[model samples]
Target: MKPFSGTSLTDHALTTGEVLLTYWKVKAEYQWDAGLAMSTYLNGLKQGKLLGIHCPQCRRTLIPPRVFCELCFRPLDQWVELANIGKINTYSVSYVNWDATRRQTPEVPAVIEIDGASPGMGILHLMGEVGDTLEAITRRLKVGTPVQAVWKPDSEREGAITDIRYFRPIG
Candidate 1:
């Protein structure tokens, strides 16, 4: 609707429609590969299971599912079941959903260093029963405190990211 001026022809376009037409010329491309390993991991979540790969070389277990070890730069061939239990390393509460479509209805997000994982290792997830005081860093939630996963109903279960509904405090 307005004329924009700049060095490039696209930037110098006289109309919004023309500018959008020129923008596609420099669009970036990406390729995604969904293989069996990833599918298996998702399926496991739906079944209320937590999985990880163990690096025999370093004796460290990686969670949140990875096919390789970045520390040793080696392919992790051995797989293991990670305890669904973990600890709240760090956490936060979001007033809005990530897509930005939902209004501010408090959601608690946390980074749990799953049990059995090497020290300082953790997975990012949400915490259950957390409210607007998500910024309460001085409270409990110590790094080694126990936690567990909260799963979705079987009927609504999908072998994907929504599998484990969320994580919660464990006694």
Candidate 2:
């Protein structure tokens, strides 16, 4: 038995606040490349295809695609094609513009959980064609409302997030 010098424990307790502050500073810098999955999935987008990853263990398809099986903690090389349509899980009206530079006239942003995806997984994009009378819209926002990405014109295409202008109602 030696002296109980818990340096690791002391260090964690002493620097907890500093650790949290450092995380806050780095959060914006940590950009996840969900878009890169497009290499595998976006071919579908270009040809109007919807792609997802299937986990054999959970037997669930994960949209936006993943390289590893999250449920089984294994690697997934299998790809599955999904429907181009999905549902809006939730949405909000944004009054602020990007970079907070100005007040956005009025826009609806939504979290769409596509069909055939794993539980608790979704994508965020702009919601278009929202009517003036908000009450007329269904507030339920159930798990199966059909939606699709509205792409920008070739002249305006920038090969980035903005390429898909917005996720709008599939009417």
Candidate 3:
């Protein structure tokens, strides 16, 4: 209680016990709608398929389907099916897990440009079955390397992004 000297406020202000602190735990629950575009896209994943929206004007097929074309500013009504196979656009090897914990086996995340979609149209997914070590994975995988989605078993799919467990290099 040495007046919390380093704080931005004047030392005397805190030393006098003028500041009040409190903590509260609140619980709230809510439902989220994925909207028309995303709902369809996620459902397709549950069925072991990839879905996208096509902009007739711009002629770009977009994954993680949007309701409207960003470039053309028009409603996207036409839905197109995309191939699970794609080429790795770029990738990174992570030594840290999502929770900031050190991982013995590094995670490989990559942007993959799906086949049959417009150029540069891709999805973010993890790479698996590449290799056991960082060096081996880096040496074996590269930009433009062909890959395919590895989906969860049909019974395990829950209509979520994780429906497809990860992408792996195709032989």
Give model 1's clash tally: 0
Clashing pairs in 2: 44-49
Instruction: Please identify which of the two predictions, 2 or 3, would achieve the higher lDDT against the true structure.
Output: 3
lDDT tens per residue, model 2, 1-171: 988865344576657764433334454566566454667675555555567888888887887787886668987767877665578887876666778865535577788887667666677787666553445344523346678877776666544555677776774
| Model 1, span 1-171: residue lDDT tens | 898876666545756556554344757898776565676677777777777778888898877657778888887667677788888888765666667765555677778888777876787787775444645532645656688888888777788766777887778
What is the Cα-based TM-score of model 2? 0.62
TM-score of 1: 0.70
* lDDT digits (tens) for residues 1-171 of candidate 3: 565556567778767878865679889888999999999889999999999889999889998799998788999899898998999999999998778999988889999999989999989999999997988999989999999999999999989999999999987
The C-alpha stretches of model 3 lying farther than 4 A from their native spots are 1-30
lDDT winner between candidates 1 and 2: 1
**Candidate order by TM-score, highest to lowest?**
3, 1, 2
lDDT of 2: 0.67
Q: Which scores higher on TM-score, 1 or 2?
A: 1
